[model samples]
Target: MPNLNNVSSPSLWQRIWQGFLTTVGTKQFFRIFAPWVKWLAILASIFLVIGSVWGLAFAPPDYLQGNSYRIIFIHVPAASLAISIYFALAVLGVIFLVWKIKTASLVAQALAPLGFLLCVISLITGSIWAKPTWGTYWVWDARLTSMLILAFLYAGVMALFAAFEHTANRGKAAAILSIVGAVNLPIIKYSVQWWNTLHQGSTFTLTAAPKMSADMWMPLLLMVVGSYLLVATLAIYRTNTLILYRDQGKAWVKEYIRGQNK
Candidate 1:
């Protein structure tokens, strides 16, 4: 008896939008989906191992830089992830500030150290590569300087968050700091072009073919994708632990603990 002909099925984009809506607002979606994060971590680990091996061994040496260029596998991905994670942190800050989502703040808090670590890795790797490429260990180059500032920004966020004892106060202060820190991200991205920096121009872009040969760029791409996955895995793992800490007293968490104990 139902008018089936008039009932239109949801489009693919509509389903995706609905799913995204469901995942925000309340923390329930994250709580329910947290267990799957470990599987993602496992998968990311596989990708990282494969990509690292392919890059360090199988990929061809650069025509100019030779083996020194191999460090690109690590440095490029780390730098990219460092900036991407900060953007994610800023977005999370906005979410917490606007929506009063405690989980968003907690996730951003957890992300700070990871982002800092990646930024540090990027800087260190860049320095190591520079010794051979640029004849110097360090320089006050625009890109390098901006990236260093980004690392300090990450540290500032962490320190500012810890400085406040109250949860709400800490969240508010950190969120504002994070949003403000986002201004540095673009500065980092465009620094090489904006200023006559020692750093090289971008090797890859979204629209054009890679400047390098396929044999060289393919492994780099794999490394980039793997690093993104690795970052996601780390974020999800940290978020899960933070959620447990924040909700340890809640009934669902209690039930989860009991279930784990069993």
Candidate 2:
């Protein structure tokens, strides 16, 4: 007879942990999400096109900055996405370190290049906007300086991952660097408020309405949402490719590849 009295069931937390691992750690997870990538790209294209056309051509120009302000459609979205992607990297670092989720690490690594590109876009567009608005192409403003540091952090994380030969070690090193670099996020967010800088405060915030009129902000909003979707599509597509490459030798990967080739 079994000693039923001594039997213990898994705790709720344990069940949830296992569920998360199964859902995210499996290659099938990517397959389930694969269809969304195309839809996301389509939606992103629609929003960006509408937003860009409205912003660049139809929307009323700023009273002071005029058409130069239209660049915000690109600059704001890129900057926002750069910051958001770093925040995601930080979250992925935590997941990888705490749960040892390989998917989280892979996704984090996949996002680094995109994050770096977005950061560069933000900086370049900002400088272009600055030359007309601030009378200089470069400044040592806190916002700009902190954003530059973010770009370096992204580069460093990518380099750290590549520096290691062992997969586990590479993930660990990159995760740790990402976690450490997350401290810079707050500094970047509050830099304008914390110091008297040449840069202005955030254009959008949850607690307050936008300072700009609807025609100006509406298209900007569309661009922001489109940019987010575009980034998400790229991230998922890249992560899926990474997963397939990493599991190239596995039976499931081989089967998937064979099917795709057909």
Candidate 3:
């Protein structure tokens, strides 16, 4: 008879190790992220091609801003993803902190740089948009101010992680910061409502129906989804790479890499 608790078989950690070994042998990291990444890439390409052709060649120019308003396709999606991806990172950060799962922590770290990049793009594009629409290059109103704060939060998290010497400690500290910042995200989202501001309310914001037509909005949606997939793929692949590097010299990890090579 099998002993109940006295003599157990392979533990959960052992199972995880074995799975890692098997997956590496098959080059499963790319295999796992590939399909989704490919889809995102394809959709993004299609959207850019179609949106550019339509916006440039077919669709009517903006009634208010005329040709300049065409920037919305790229600018809107970038701003949306900037906020969305950081929130997702914070969720993953929470999982990492609570479970002490190395993979989860690695993902949070890898994605931070990408999120920062998005935040930068959003701010730049928003500035360009604001120049014609708001008659200025920048504003200090609620939405704009809050988004600036969000970008700084991303920088702070990256700085915090880098400031630490030990990898494990860095992960824990970053996770804590992410969780705290995540709580502030909602406040940022609602700041326009909370206070009167110069920045125009969100065009694609969740609170109201989209003001643009299908022709204008469809490509924006495509870009948003495509950007999300691209980020997720980058995060997973980078995290896996980090795991392999960190695990180097360990017996199981060596075996896992060897299997991947084969």
Select the stronger candidate by lDDT from 1 and 2: 2
lDDT per residue for candidate 3 within 1-262, as digits (tens), equals 8778897699899999888655543235435653565566666567667665675566667778897877777777777777887887788787777755556666777888888888888888889989988889898877777788888889988888788737548677888888888876886678877888776667775677788877766666665665665676677667667766766766767776688799
By descending TM-score, how would the candidates be arranged? 2, 1, 3
Q: Against the correct fold, how does model 1 do in TM-score?
A: 0.89
Instruction: Summarize candidate 1's per-residue lDDT along 1-262 as a digit string, tens digits.
Output: 9999999999999999788766753257456667778787787788789888988998888889999999999999999989988998899999888877677887787788989999999999999999999999999999999999999999989998788746558778878988999999989988887889899988898988899998888888888888888777778778778778777788888888899899
Model 1 lDDT vs. the true structure? 0.86
Candidate 2 residues 220-250, lDDT tens each? 9999999999999999899999888888899
Off by over 4 Å in 2: 1-14, 165-167
Model 3 scores a C-alpha lDDT of: 0.73
CA-lDDT, candidates in order: 0.86, 0.91, 0.73
Ranking by lDDT: 2, 1, 3
Q: Which candidate is the best by lDDT?
A: 2
- In model 2, the clashing pairs are none
Q: What is the TM-score of each candidate against the true structure?
A: 0.89, 0.95, 0.79
* Better structure of 1 and 3 per TM-score: 1
lDDT of 2 at 187: 95
Q: Which stretches of candidate 3 lie over 4 Å from their true place?
A: 1-40, 51-57, 165-167, 205-208, 250-262
